[model samples]
Target: MYTSTPFNIADQLPKGLQALMYRAQGAMDNEASGLQRRSFLKVVSASGFALGAFPLLTQAQAQAATPAAAASALKPTQQPSAFVHIAKDGTVTVTINRLDFGQGVQTGLPMILAEELDADWRLVKSQHGNADPAYADPVMGMHLTGGSSAIKNSYTQYRELGARTRAMLVAAAAAQWGVDASSLRTREGVVIGPGGKRLGYGELAEAAMLQPVPEKVTLKDPKQFRIIGKPTGRLDARAKSSGGQSYGIDTRLPGMLTAVVAHPPVFAGKVKSLDDAAARAVPGVKAVLRVPLDRGGEGVAVVAEGYWAAKQGRDALKVDWDTSTVEKVDSAQQLASYRALAQTSGALKYNADVSPLATAPKKISAEFVFPYLAHAPMEPLNCTVQLSGQGADTKAELWLGTQMPGLDTLAASQVLGVAPQNLKMNVQMAGGGFGRRGIPSSDYVVEACAVAKAARTAGLTAAVRTLWSREDDIKGGYYRPMHVHRAEIGLDAQGKILAWDHVIVGQSIIAGSPFEPFMVKDGVDATMVEGMKEPYDIPMRLSVHHPKLNVPVLWWRSVGSTHTAYVMETLIDEVARSAGQDPVAYRLQRFGDKHPRHRAALQLAVSKSGYGKRTLAAGRAWGVAVHESFNTVVAYVVEASVKGTTPVLHAVTAGVHCNLAINPTSIEAQIQGAALMGLSMCLPGAAITLKEGVVEQSNFGDYQVPRITDMPTVAVFIAPSADAPTGLGEPGLPPLAPAFANAIAKLTGQAPRELPFKLA
Candidate 1:
């Protein structure tokens, strides 16, 4: 195994208004293309950002654009009672409605608020909010941090929150001076009255609380924006970079016991027998208890004074795991099964005619495979649970970094036998989640609560923290599903798509979850076929098979685009080559005028990259790819070369169009980290393979992650827009692998059919 320090980009780095339809409010960000087939919303392919802009901001921005309106009704959840807090020291703290697992919403959302509040940037700070109804997304009506909707969905809400606070502060200042509120103006935390009278927001904060909260207030226009578009540094950047930051794993409670679970080797396997004689002999060992696991299984947890003692105690225990009931998944055999299924007609997703395929001038039949991937966030999954009292009077507190705090709270409360209202969730700073910590089952959280409950039942009164080692996190269940995409592509004489017949085989991510009714329709998982067609208009028959597998899978970053973008882009490049045309030009021609955002993004990357103007070294070639995910578009123009069997990415230039650039520096960091992660897909040993129902790889020793040296020189440039920002987190990742594959294809004269590049 190679040796290296953990390359954690999380420590290092970094929407418009339109429809009010329920589908728009609760819709997935990447469904701009899926609108046509979706029964709820009519598809408007010609208009990209207009149709999918954050829907709640339409009337809010219009009415709130003015300084003050006749007081309108404010939903209890919309009031700023819990969000904006001012200290006597003039420190303005903004509470973010979502978790900050390195996406910089901890800073970005505050920028939106502080901008509208006209607060001094130097004095503004941010903190993560709890699972209160006040923090829930107004549109989705949930405590969610995914789909890049934090700023997009909350822009108007935060603006109004800031404006209302400003209004109340002005009203307080005006009443003190016996002047109308309109006569006073706010500038950098100060209310300026007639004759240069001024007061800091700190002095008026308490008095401002007594004033009526305004429902509508003015928002600065794009031209008047001083902080919104400015490339300000992240509030947490210094703490993160300086190693002074605290994550959930760093929590230390009084008399808290540390826990390490000895999970069954096979998923859903049960512990046949567990002997804790040696485990109990360990000096710091407190207790050894068998607890119920997620998926109706059982595991033994070792509770000790600390993590090291707990782990040692766990290692000393003897456990017998029963694998008889669970399915033994073999990667080789599974691939064979998937390939076999791809040959037949599966459930129909799109029923476009295939008659043109038989009569087309040329045809290309290709099959691509993608393997399961672990999230592997820098901090392994963990949760600290403190239980007090019992039964109906039970009160519990949990500390963790969670994407879906509300769901996790519900799950933990149920496991701990505490009422949901009695459970207090402290949203902690997370190293990174990338979608692992947001499981619908709330697996880790539930397991922690279960361990605490078992400990309490066993007479241990202290709180318990369930900690997963790096090995456990890597081998843990929720992984990106393995996928096989088989396609028959037909091209006319002009190289336009005559027909595309496609079949995908993979496990459904949302099948058994509470979201199954909404996310899975007509037996087709919506996440499986997201990135296919449009952005380019192509007629095709799309089919899918969601084989139920024993392994649990969740939405990894960018979800379906992790595989779909690779298939579509590589195949598109191949078709472009066959047609003797430039890949970028071909994609541009396909984009036409229907998608101006895509066109602008591609053009920006092309011009900034000097694609045709600069001459590359003989060994290196320019590679290009563009994709839209989470409603954000990212285009890459890369310079790449091959060294032996490995692909070497030399330089990358990204053209990002998420409408508005809230923080260009943060956007750059996200792209760099995501691209490096994408490069990991092409490295040897990247796949999370399984054999005999046991994970073949455990930790970084066996798995391959990109090292710092492997990172290319990435340059990011944004295409500016006045429209609201869209998702920026996952879009950067999807196009990176396909662009690298396209580059390697140019060097080898043959495209890679699988990830981790099996080149000869």
Candidate 2:
């Protein structure tokens, strides 16, 4: 039997990728042995690689990136040298610290940097960075891209990086021509001397690196921005459009072997016995070995020459699984348990008086059920692990679209018994991750490493790639936790909320991970209640139950907002209807002066969609929802018409107030994609149900998602502002389904409470 539970995914899902990176080498509870959080960050900021007044990357450093010199990030007063690399041919390649898994940071981040660098827009390109410290998030001090933090957190950092690169080029040209650097200027990748002499960045690049990175540089003013606010195309747009783009799934190494694991039907179920006689007889079969799985599970990995062979070999295997010790979670039974818990007191998050609920003139009680959801990224889950040498002196290289390379490196190092410095992670572009690739456990990476280790132990010297098929991934654990929300509201005669007693029952996304100490407080996991109450300003007595079920839950697209926004917005619209007020007007009334962003976004969507000024078609009705997540506000105004049992979405207009739109096209793309994903929640077969601890849906046939046929005509309008840009990758998704739900309610006099629409 598998070992008893210790630290699992709830601990790893984290509060959107914030974890203790310095203490990753030891046990989950090892907090005191490593550098304290604040102290470690201070050290990194103070003494971390300072590229100021030095070559961006020395010849030796350029050839190899070791852990001792891993951090190349500059301080506030220093200049960034690692992110931007100028080629000899004048092509500028910007290394993005975050994974560009369809979020469009592939171009947005570089736009910000290239704008300040005064580089030729046509020559700009982007690539993903490795596990080096230079690529870590400035705020979190980890190599993370979740929480829509990529552009938001790196905005100013990239701006300064570009500016400093420009300054360094100027200095290089100045020194070459023996002129005062102050007398020189740069424009469109060229350094202009006093006599109008121009030096292309390409000609000055080598010299520029030899010169020092400018200690202080001037960032471009918003009005002077040529690239930042433009609707620039993604660096990989043409490749993606032409079907030539390479994802992590396309990784190919010389003599690399493919692997497919035969996991137990039940999560964390142990393997009692196995017979690989048929598997071994198959041609191209390498070897099959029993290995430990994530969260204390056991499975057999089949290694072969190719994916088809591995899959075929896996299909031929026979094994008996012991699931007696693990949880056999039944969806129906879990719902029953959640329903019962809704009546009891749980961990108090927000303590507001709910006494008015008993005697208020108006009252509404509602309950919601959201089923477990799989990420189901197009790329599936694949990690290619290559190891050379053995044991302590062994060196490793990994290729994958990993969300948390820092943690992955630590986990891989321990698994292969290699030093952190000896390992190199080649970050690849992912087709889509939503949140699967960024799991706290680095499960996929560890599994791949385990398979590679097992292969080497079996005398197979080639690199091994552990690939999960569509079935394996869909049935894989670490899904969006199913949530049950109960809300009892007390409202005044005018539709103003007087009191809201709310209860959310779901597994904590970050309960046991090393960061639990910092995130979960007083028995409350803040992530579980993110979008519960806000903007509208209402007294909400919020409580949550972090039930310990065997199921592992992680953050999906927008984290908790995936469900919270739906619950909050639909309930808000329902409350508005009960008050005999127009949902839009009622929402505006509630906005007051405290939420001008929300009000403006809503007004923008209304005005843009002609929501109130124009009449809809015969069967059409307007649905509106506005929510703010990750410091960005998105308002959706949609038209819906019901056809029998199906709710037909006609059109959608989005109003986004994210302070700044770095690249209008990228923003539009994110919103368009996110809105479509949001629509998925209402589609049939959208829910992932567990029966007897086994996932009932194994692939897209049983577990459905939003397809092109389901998409509505969508238009995105961004609010104008000079403020630093906020995130767009996730904010657009939270309010979409709720807005659609609100519209469906307008057509039919009922508010939908369950996802995948159980309406008859």
Kindly list the per-residue Cα lDDT of model 1 for residues 1-760, writing each as its tens digit.
0000000111111011112212222322223213322221221112211111221222222232233331446653466655777776678888888999988898888988888889999999888887665677776666778777787778888888888889888988998999999999989989999999999988877666556677668788878888887777899989989999999999999999999999998899998988999999999999999988988778999999999999999999899898898899999999999999999888888989888999999999999999999999999999999989876889899999999887787788678877666677899999999899888899999999999998999999898989999999999889999999999999976789989999999999988876676667788887888888757788889999999988999988888888988999999999999999999999999988799989988898898889999999989998999999888888999999998887888999888888877777778878888888888888888989999999989998889998888888988888989898876777889888889889988999978999877877
Off by over 4 Å in 1: 1-72
* Model 2 lDDT per residue over 1-760, tens place: 0000011122243454444454442332232223243443332234222221111232223223233323444442123545766766788888888998999998998898899999999988888877755677776667787888889888988988888778778878888999998898888888888778998988877666545555467777688988888887788989999999998889888999999999889989989989999999889999998988998999999999999999999999999999999989999999999999988779998899989899889999999999999999989999999989865679889999988888898889889898776777889999899989998788888889999999899999998989999999999989999989999999989898889999999999888765677668899887888877887689999999989999988989888888899999999999999989999999988888888889888898898899889989999999999999888999999999899889888899999998988888888888889999999988889999999999999988899887778899999888888899887778888998899999999888987899978779
Residue pairs of candidate 1 with colliding backbone atoms: 15-724, 15-725, 66-218
Task: Evaluate all candidate structures by whole-model CA lDDT and list the values in order.
Answer: 0.82, 0.82
Candidate 2 ranges beyond 4 A from true positions: 1-79
Total backbone collisions for each predicted model: 3, 2
Q: TM-scores across all candidates?
A: 0.91, 0.92
Candidate 1: residue 253 Cα off by (Å): 0.8
Q: Report per-prediction Cα RMSD to one decimal.
A: 10.1, 7.3
- How far does residue 22 in candidate 2 sit from its true spot (Å)? 4.9
For this target, which candidate reaches the highest TM-score against the unseen true structure?
2
